[model samples]
Target: MKKLLAAALTGAAMLATPAMAQADEGKIQFKLLGTYVMPDGEITSVNTDIVGLPAGTQTTASDNFVPTLAIEYFVSPEFSIETICCMTQHDVDAVSGLTGAELVSDGKLIPATFTAKYHLNAGDVKPYVGAGATYFWWVDAEPGADTIPLGVTRTTLSDEFGFVVQAGVDIALGDGGMGVALDAKRYFVGTTARWYAGDTLAIETEHDLDPWVLSAGVSYRF
Candidate 1:
């Protein structure tokens, strides 16, 4: 009887281990993520006047695989708050009636979001959707002609507010609370792109700069 009881108890202990692990995995956690954004659109300055030099199209771009980080905490199984510290440096280029110029605008952007997440039934794969807001400030832009001139008050995006929509999924790890996840978000960053030389201000275009973000990383549930 003692030998039989010992074997049964060991089997029971093994069964309870995985169940306890799953329950503890529900705890809130943090993650560090990296992202790469590919810009596929153009921000242009249009000519309002029927005469004079025509306005031009300027392209903004970033180097491959920009570095970023994300942290997440769950208030409940269905809700969470997340924040990211990521920045972009765009090379600005223009060509207007055969006249060409270039410059750079670099800044750090922080996105803080509160989201309502619905976990899937399958514990191995969890997919969720979220919506939130964002704020971006033009931290530094080079001082030069043809670029957003330095210190032009409100001409550049000193600090602007916007909205964010995101989606992602988390894949479970090997019998652990740590796993991999993929996320993507669309940010509608309201812009204030201005051009003025002397008294004439060109089209004061408010940019609806919508950028797409894609990222993947490992996460842990504490």
Candidate 2:
């Protein structure tokens, strides 16, 4: 991940020099976007491991395409505050290590975030990096008979804080009235789920909800 960030920064710097025609400062920019969540991350359950449910017991969230809306207020020529608006739904799945059976299927997770960005240069083509916080909520879980050993009846994931790191580039289109934006954000989210068995306290397990989100969109500046 560090290598990827370094490469992106290097590439963005190379592209920054030629597109220095400068965008308007203090303007509001809106983006209509499409996003893809890469399914390369994992969620671990030590409770399942403790119970010795299976050898390869693992949990993962599903990946899909989703729509997103983002608004950015350029505070200065090189700085902006951004908030992405969208309800992202992901299906969580747990697989049994022994029988290779799916234990929990179709559990849902949703996240929202806010970021502050620093544009590398005040140009028509802007490459920037950002840092932010995120809120993750777990909802609607379907745990099957395969998951009984974990004693999880009601699913309650602790709503907690997470950090976000992002990098993006905006390229001017036509005469610079509109543009295209390509962005990537990596979320560092880890939390514990309070599992209940029929109103009785059951288990607490760690879930690593880290995900890399990639987006592309059209941007309009005013």
Candidate 3:
């Protein structure tokens, strides 16, 4: 009777091992992060300069830090799909020619992005790399303080599509579905800025808005 009981206990242990391993791998994860947005807002070219912008007129966009939320779904143990939600604001100012002149103010945007990531699991540390697409949706924008003096009553930015590449790492705290996450993404995007005077378009300029996004925070999986 003791031999039979020992064999039964051994079989149960073998069955529990697989269940414990599966429990450690979660299917969904949520991350709350703080992100630093740094953008290069250099003017690539002037499409239409009705206001007679001075020669050597150059522009730049300001940087911002905001809260971000990321959701990830693991399709397999080594592959996952992820998306993030965040809204960032920026101001465009002249860096040269009319130095210190603000050209655009309070430009709010939402960068909708999706990525497919491959994770390399090395013990408790998992590193991932991904590439995906993004769409820059301009929610609101206004002419700057200086532009209002130039009969610029209204301003608009074109919504555009772009691409992004991502890399990050997740360090597991314990067997419990909690981890610390660090991520970085680089975006290649552009926009056309138009300033209007009543019903007439006054200025149109093309800008390169390549931005580097850095984030760090805690993540939970279930």
Best by TM-score: 3
Give the C-alpha lDDT of model 3: 0.94
Q: Give the lDDT of residue 114 in candidate 1.
A: 46
Per-candidate local distance difference test: 0.61, 0.73, 0.94
Shift in Å, residue 80, candidate 3: 0.6
Model 2: which ten-residue window has the lowest total lDDT?
17-26
Model 2 stretches with alpha carbons more than 4 Å out? 1-26, 39-52, 95-100, 144-152
TM-score to true structure, per model: 0.70, 0.75, 0.91
State the lDDT of candidate 1 residue by residue for 136-222, as single tens digits: 766655423444443222224446777888899988786667889899988777555554444555435434456788898888877
Evaluate residue 82 in candidate 2 and report its C-alpha lDDT on the 0 to 100 scale. 94
Best by the lDDT measure: 3
Summarize candidate 2's per-residue lDDT along 1-222 as a digit string, tens digits.
999999999999879855453443337999999998764325465653334444555666667788899999888777899988766555446644434444445556677789999998645678999999998765656654555666767655566689999999988786655899999999988766555678765545677778899999899887
lDDT for each residue of candidate 3 in 62-153, tens digit (9 for 90 to 100)? 99999999999999878999999999999999999999999999999999999999999787899999999999999999999999988999
Model 2 reaches what TM-score against the true structure? 0.75
Model 3 weakest 10-residue run by lDDT = 17-26
